[model samples]
Target: MRRRFKLATLTAALCLLLVSLSGCGQSLAQKDILQLDRHSNEITWGVKADTKLFGLMDVRDNQIKGFDVDMAKHITKHILGTKGQAKFIQVTSQSRIPLLKNGNIDAIIATMTITPERAKIVDFSNSYFDAGQSLLVPNGSDIKNVRDLNKPGMTVLGVVGANSVQNIKKYAPKARVLELQDYAQALTSLKAGQGQALTTDNGILYGMAVQNPGFKVVGGTFTKEPYGVAVNKGQRPFVREINKAIKEMQADGEYNALIKKWFGNVPGFNYKELER
Candidate 1:
């Protein structure tokens, strides 16, 4: 009887172990973004809701609009056909990676730059947009470029969690850096005279400039900031599909058209330079 009880206990523990292993396998399979999207026929994307020319909330329509949003929709069509829905969830720089890691978002297309540090945590798609770090200053200000901000007592505004803030440290070692929550807040602070210059990607600066004519993007790009779509570390399939879709769009001229549609008329910007 003692031997039989021991045998029964051992058998039950083994069964529990197998069940736990099976659960783990199911969890991993569920996290495979490509398979998940296929099964649901939808791609949930994390995108910026504050940056103009990239992604911005359209208050009138209660929908987000901009280049990133459009690109995501087209990519969804390419990947999942006409029926596959592209769902956009607003994400800030601070939240995007965490949200992705936690399975809250399938991918990130929020003007995110691919850096070695970030690559360690998540996989990135091929460069979809070529951008560069630059500065925005009030017109007629003596600060013509990034170099001007290197002087002591000069204050530069940057968005928190954006690589631009880190990049600025290399260029303006002596300048005081103030990090804001978003582009809107940075621009507001800049306008309020809280900082002498606002720094970020030239494309984003240009978007701000277009709306606020008093300010302008200066100091042509200081660092290359090639934007890429980000997926969880193990999601190679999703990354490949995104890369493939980008190439198709470029090949068919859809990419250039989107570029023109959003950027063609911006003052002081050469839209053709961005066209594929």
Candidate 2:
């Protein structure tokens, strides 16, 4: 009787262990966002809170608003069948990758440039916005463009962890470089005379120019910085869904409408080709 009881206990314990393992395996396999509406109901997204035009916080409305924000909202609506269901997590360029990797964000809709180097770390959706590197300088400054900054002792301010500093070196090898913490800090340093110019994407520079009339983006783009949405590597289904959403927006005129809403009136920027 004692042996039979022991055998029964062991059998029950083995069954429980198998059930637990099976549950874990199912959870792992069910992680991808195959059904947008259902999954986004439980997921949160990471978006830029600082980037102007692309992403910015609307202090008066107490909501984050911009082109990227609108785009993300639209994507959520299309995928989840509702817009307000998913939550938004504010992210910076330096924090986007880490947050996505740690599973804090379901996806990134910031103005992240797609590059081969970054591709090794995170998966990128199709290019949503085309942009290029450019220079921003104080109004009436003699430095009209990159060519003028090729001389030694010329200082350039760039954000840390961004490829902008490296591109600055390649294009203006003689200029002294100062890396700031973020775009706001870079602008502050530039205004404080820490650097002769600021280097970043033209879209962002344009936004800055609109805000601070004292600064202007000079010269055309020096390097293409195609912006793309990023997800964790191997999340092919999520990437595909985002790409499909972008393509649909482009085809349905929503993409061009967003471009016009943010960039149509910006001086010197031609928004013709961006129209659907």
Best by TM-score: 1
lDDT for every model?
0.92, 0.83
Give one digit per residue, the lDDT tens place, for model 1 in 169-270: 999999999999888898899999999999999899999998898998887888999999999887898899999999999999999999999999888888
lDDT of 1: 0.92
Q: What is the TM-score of each candidate against the true structure?
A: 0.90, 0.85
Clash counts for all predictions: 0, 1
Which pairs of residues collide in candidate 1?
none
Query: What's the CA RMSD for each of the models?
Result: 4.4, 6.1
- Give the number of colliding residue pairs in candidate 2: 1
lDDT per residue, candidate 2, 192-225, as tens digits?
Answer: 9888899999988898888899998999898999
Give the best candidate by lDDT.
Answer: 1
